[model samples]
Target chain A: MSESNTIPKSLQEAIGTESKKLSNDIEKGAIRRFAEAIEDNNPLYVDENYAKSLGYRNVIAPPTFLRSVQTDPLPDHIKSPYSAVVDGGSVWEYFSPVCAGDIITTITTFENVFDRDGRLGNMIFLIKTTRYTNQLSELVATQTTTSITYEPKKEN
Target chain B: MNQNLYFEDIKEGMEIPTIKKNPTTQQLVKYAGASGDFYQIHYDMDYAKNNGLPGVILHGALKNAFLGQVITDWIGNSGKLKMLEVQYKGMDLPGTPVYAKGIVTDIIDENNINCDLWLETDKGDKTTVGKAIIQLPKK
Candidate 1:
């Protein structure tokens, strides 16, 4: 493959593929752990009464708490030869608050692929999106991630 | 842990209060476990070095959370973050000071506020840039 046309056929075939998964009921302990890890002191994220005071059913997760919602990786059939991967970044659109006790379900879609010449050489940007909905079927949030994959640097 | 920010009190050019973070390797470990992103490069020095990284680097999700804190801490409890977008431009390593900063870009509907946000290195390099839209409560 030429340097300009580096995105492999496997990744291209994976586009538009999707997988659905469920998250553990949003737990107070998990929320608090994430909050402490980030050093956030917002009571709304850990204190149930405080969240209720703000009209939430229970302690609400932080704005970025959706990071805790883990999902299955791509199927083995769509493997890329790249050895190292890093996050390119993320975009989020939140429609409603994700509070504790909410059992969330995520529908993740393998969305797009692009190749760019980056600082580390030609890197493939793999885009995927996950939509989260609560038990009530209310769409809570949607997040898209850009994962950058490239050849690993050999040990010197 | 201060006064609540209201839509009426914000100006287009207003600078939101900055939030600083000194992410330790331990915090990175905790974040990896909490976020389930144990991708080796974030906490494994040898793995990182083998992959051309100088050392273990901070996770982009952690940077995202940091920027999220900057916005939520400024908007107070009543405000809501409607949209947040982050682009990781450079790798931020552990133990370095990162400043999460933002400035109000526009005020729409007399309630919705749009802003440009970033995670800046000590030398003023924006390792990560983002945009945010927040809705502040009426005063």
Candidate 2:
């Protein structure tokens, strides 16, 4: 297996380029579906009355619910040459809750690109950081994600 | 349905309550639909097996959501979850019980508490490891 650095110069040049996307107003039905998918019956994510009792304007979303909202286009430069890509990990920071009816927006930046040796062989990793804001332009949350791209070894 | 935990009520080294989750293939399918992540690895067992996975695996984001629940449920209504960071080290399969556990690692102040959290399989293999910071109401 070859171990040369696999990240293309074009892709490397994309680091720090930011892209933005805005989402539709968060919906209660969508939040409920997400809560059900995760099998969390938390009233904060499902029952509006329960959330109101907790002082929330409406049913709020789970911390990771933003995953369902950000529908955006990925810049072509971020795509890897390898056929397989695996999620390396993620770090998330939350400042405010995302309530139903709040339209969310995100600004994503290509943060880093690097290569490393792994059990399989040489791997290239890419990191992206995204900032999420609500309709009031309040910072809601931020997530940093790392992904690894590699070619599968050929079996004899 | 648990009682709210105030900052004064919890101490360092104390274990927060655990939330047990059993992710079924059906749930993964629903999660795929709700999340708009139509990646075949989460639903197509054969495709996943061909891709080096033993079988259909749970989505990493879904596991993160479970950890979020662990913190939010423990903090109750008054307290707020400030941050959650997780690293996916191992793959988890559907039909297995994954337990989300946490131990209070540091008391930053009267209002902030830090915890070391992880998700482990019934066999005790840690599938995810991370840290979380929660803001608890001062009593």
Number of the top candidate by DockQ? 2
What is the Cα-based lDDT of residue A142 in candidate 2?
94
Candidate 1 chain B lowest-lDDT run of ten = B106-115
lDDT, candidate 2, residue A43? 83
How is the predicted docking of candidate 1 categorized under the CAPRI scheme? high
True-structure lDDT of candidate 1: 0.87
Q: What is the TM-score of chain A alone in each candidate?
A: 0.89, 0.92
Give the clash count for each candidate: 0, 0
Please give each candidate's TM-score: 0.91, 0.94
Residue A26 error, candidate 1, Å: 1.0
Interface RMSD (C-alpha) of each candidate? 0.9, 0.8
Residue range B20-134, candidate 1, lDDT tens digits: 9999999999998888888899999999998778999998889999989999999887788999999989999998999999999988864467999999998999999999999
Worst 10 residues of 2 chain B by lDDT: B108-117
- Scored against the native two-chain complex, candidate 2 gets a DockQ of 0.83
* lDDT winner: 2
Q: What are the per-residue Cα lDDT tens digits for candidate 2 across B1-139?
A: 7788788899999998999998999999999999988999999989998888899999999999999999988988888888888889899999999999999999989556889999999889999998898888777
